[model samples]
Target: MPAQVLAPAPAVTPPRAGRGYWRRLLPALAVLACLTRVPSFTRPLWNPDEGYLAVQARILAHGGQLYETVVDRKPPLVPWLYEAAFAVTGSGSLTSVRVLAVLAQLLTAALLAALARRRWGDRAGRTAGVLYLLVSVGLNPEDAQAAGFEVFILPGTAAAMWCADRRRWTAAGVAVGCAVLAKQTGGAVLLPVLWLCVTSGAARTAAPRLAAGAALPVLGAALLTDPAGFLFWTVTGSTAYAAFSGSPLHALTRALGNAGLLAAACAGLLAAVARAPRAASADLWLWLAASAGAVLTGFHFFGHYYLQLLPPLALLATAALHTEPWARHRTAVLVSACACAVFLTWGLTAPRAELTHAQRVAEAAARRTGPRDPVLIWGMHPETYWLARRAPASRYLTAGLLTNYSGGRDGARVGERYAVDGAWPVFRREMTARAPALIVDDSRGKPYAPAHVPTLRRLLTDRYRVVGTVDGAVLYARVS
Candidate 1:
């Protein structure tokens, strides 16, 4: 017989090359997300934002109304999300909320991967997922790792973009609405979603569906909360809160500095995108612009605000990297790694004494009061309420409302000039109605010291006596 000639075996592609591979790899990616944030699990509080949300959530879980009984300027969903997490993991478990934040981070990575895979290829998808997992927590671990509003909003905003890419108009709108419920800046996602619709000439068909879908969550939230209070805190009052009362020169310098730092941290990814044959798509450009607007909204330029920029940037960067040569790809990777190392090292090693001090004050306050006894913190450390597991004596979690000290500006110069006249009466009524059993003054003098306010000074002098001082916080117990 003639030598049998076997045809060259067809190129065998590994299972990972298949379309279903990304879906199968999702679980592993989710695990990566959790692993990256493990440090968050050890700390009870990473930021004051978490402390405020935790305290408000506890109040909500205990049948207190949102804006009425417990006050915060954020939208209602985050507190409710925290309440749900508490229900599952037991009340006051900061660890559980951190877990919830990890889950959100995982979902966002998955969505970004799926979107990239649909648009480019499997490699791009995997790169996007891994890049997001690394960079999201790389900027400032203290803020990024916390179960803050920024962490929670990413999943919703990313989902909206994924749905929009698929032309699922109604679902995309619903996702945007949910994102807004997490934070007002989240609504910035809607601009890109609408841009997609208009660019595709589907505005007529998609716009109405998008509107209807977006209304579901907003209307639902309104029904569940005090409508007037919800509007005031989330919308009306936010006007004043968002205003830039600080010096224009200072604002400009800070904006440039923060923006530069963020750009430097993502230098590799930005370079890859710039070098790609096909630059970012119009919708993505709009998405980046919208997210940038969101970050600059309050002119505060906080570290975590930069998080809103990551999803779109990750997608753009990974998609661009897919077509780059190996040498260039290696260079991009090296730059990004160095940047991440610097930021992560600084964030992880930064002193946590302030948090430790807050914990000590809470412990001191707890020793002097019962679990149900209401306690008031004269300073801005709402974490004390959550740590001590005591109800707040007043709805004002921080003295910002009373002192008119905007977190966005120099608290000293802007003090009292912008103080809400209406808040003082409400504070007096609530404090008089149910006096706190303990008062923890963590003000450390100057801005929010009770001595600065005659009313607060008299109340402290007449009703309470200093029992102890821990760190810088003074604990006063009610005289029997």
Candidate 2:
């Protein structure tokens, strides 16, 4: 046969790589949205911390100050986030708060999936996303329902890891700084970040970039607002938090209670080390260790605290799962099945009683007080203040913030310092100055009761009378 000239195969264009990434990410995001979004709406704001955050954000949005008008033992970033959310969607809407929270979690999952895929492979990445969604939504009932600090910082941590893996040192540093702004514990991300910069052949160039990036957000926070207040709350105020929350032993007990999570975390780290030495290096393991320390330092050991561990654990677990001899397809199938099963378990066990009661209380509070009025709540339900659209009668939105619990169970020496005898008169003075339209006694004879704020107790008895009751909380209207 005569040799024939054949036209070169038409230059084939590889479909843009980004399109493939989105194609995979969109479906996963849809699944995560289904797992988190709608369910958040059905749940009520029962967490005191969530309430504190929502109300504080509203205060900041309304031209008031953080740490001055509203005090919390957390960094300013979280409230700033809530402030932005409230600004976009009216401050009065709890749905807005829930939406903000769900969006944060979903973003974390996306970043986590991207990082996993980048470090390992496509299948590993997909597994990481599913695992994160499952564990996040399946957080223990006591701490899972309302958005917490962990949720806000998770995406930032994941983004830092992803950027570091790509050798984008400055961006990764910025991510770490943002995470710290969300919660002081996020500072732990720096260890692994430094590890990456040091290990990367170009340590001199990378380290300085990383440090420069990290300083921008923090410096901005200091220059733009109350540096003194920020220092006090994030640094000084937080010094006493762990002591007041509980002991290290209590945190250990909580960790033991969630043995499955711990097992998975260990498995992933060990598996990656065995199968993918370069991928799971000492620096990465150090990141995991640092993350664990961050979680334990709080000592409170709330279920939400473990959310901080999800990124490293998910990465390790996915790598570990990949090491199995089973076919990749089979391994993926197993991961999907487990995620679905745990998700179902969470669905079945979730309670509705709190939801129903919260609705009733919110409705009652809204009816009794105007949006501009001040409301005094004796116990620690800041959600009611958010729902009522009322300013707190005092900066001590929760009595615990101003009450001395030194001799009590979760005792700490600093309680006397912060909640000094001087605090009671201030609390009484503020309540009198505010002249709240409605006083909510949430105690129902709990330990944080009339005795906790005797002055407020007397004021409530002398100037207000019981008007109605909802979910064990008594509402007292000022006698006109």
Candidate 3:
């Protein structure tokens, strides 16, 4: 009797949608992305490193000069973006450029979400987007303050992946090229794309695909941006930085960590690719590209430089976070938080070395300098530029990368090339000819005085006399 009654009780319906399904989830996540990434609308000077970018952008926007104006090696896309931003907003302050980062990052988050749809379906996609929004929020404080293209790592990766997910080679190539334009390090992203094509080419159903579509845009960007700049990147940015890393394990360790974390994160992506239906794994080609970037850029790799690989990595992390039990994600987030705090503090503080030196020189020189009076700098650090910001009074003297700092190996290198390229000509033709009243050379350094370097001292010969000196630098004048 009880069984008969139960049978008659009618069937209960199953609960189908979770409270935050993918469709409902994305908008909310987008809002959250905007909130975290868009705060502090208008504050902070451009970080010194960023100043070069801003200056170059102004030069390009006005068509002044490309490689000549900005001696730094990278291509011209970031500066161009900054110029266009200035055009529309009519604001050239560091703040205006920062807003562009927000937009780039937002688009990046959206890209990650689209990528997720390919990997884990809707839920994973939305969650990955949310995580991207979170990552953008926690960028180094100084990073938050600047308006440069470094933050595009995530969005750019996402864009490439988005195109790959749809089998859109031309669009994918354009996205990859755009990413490279944003940062030279972004060229590594193509590995993922090629991997997909090659893997697919093996299948009977999959036809031979055009790899040139992706490679061509990046090649075109290199040509348009600066053929010389690309060559310089190979010579200076890549090779020199690699050589620099040889002196310090710091660069090597950070690179290993970035690669290891990326690889661990990518294992899940590879798994997802394996589990995916045919043509499904092409979407993961973005991860391959990002990993390639991590490997190549490990040489001069600053944390901010690693930003390009982060979005795809985070999406892969989302897959990990989603699959793993509670303990791991909790551990990962906490570790990431602590690391971020340390990183943010360092980013905000590290520039002080150059900034303070510049401030001191500027203040001191401002007191003594006249517009027409020539000023000469003898030390080897590039501190004069920063100091010059405050004290534009004296003309900077010295050649082939002179420092405002009193001592360094760079100063040594100039001496090594003295007879061939030295300040002797500058002294006779520029400073002595004009008879400047003051020459400042920052003499102080961690190890010792740069003024003591024989070449610098030797170079400051009979034509210019030592008038005065300071804690770190010194002042010289053409003998009057």
Q: Give the top-scoring candidate (lDDT).
A: 1
TM-score of decoy 3: 0.66
Q: How badly does each model clash, as a count of residue pairs?
A: 0, 1, 20
lDDT of each: 0.79, 0.68, 0.51
TM-score, every prediction: 0.90, 0.82, 0.66
lDDT of 3 at 420: 22
- Model 2 misplaced regions, further than 4 Å: 1-18, 244-253, 258-279, 328-336, 354-371, 404-426, 452-471, 474-480
Clashes of 1: 0
**What's the C-alpha lDDT at position 415 in model 1?**
47
Ranking, lDDT, top scorer first: 1, 2, 3
Best by TM-score: 1
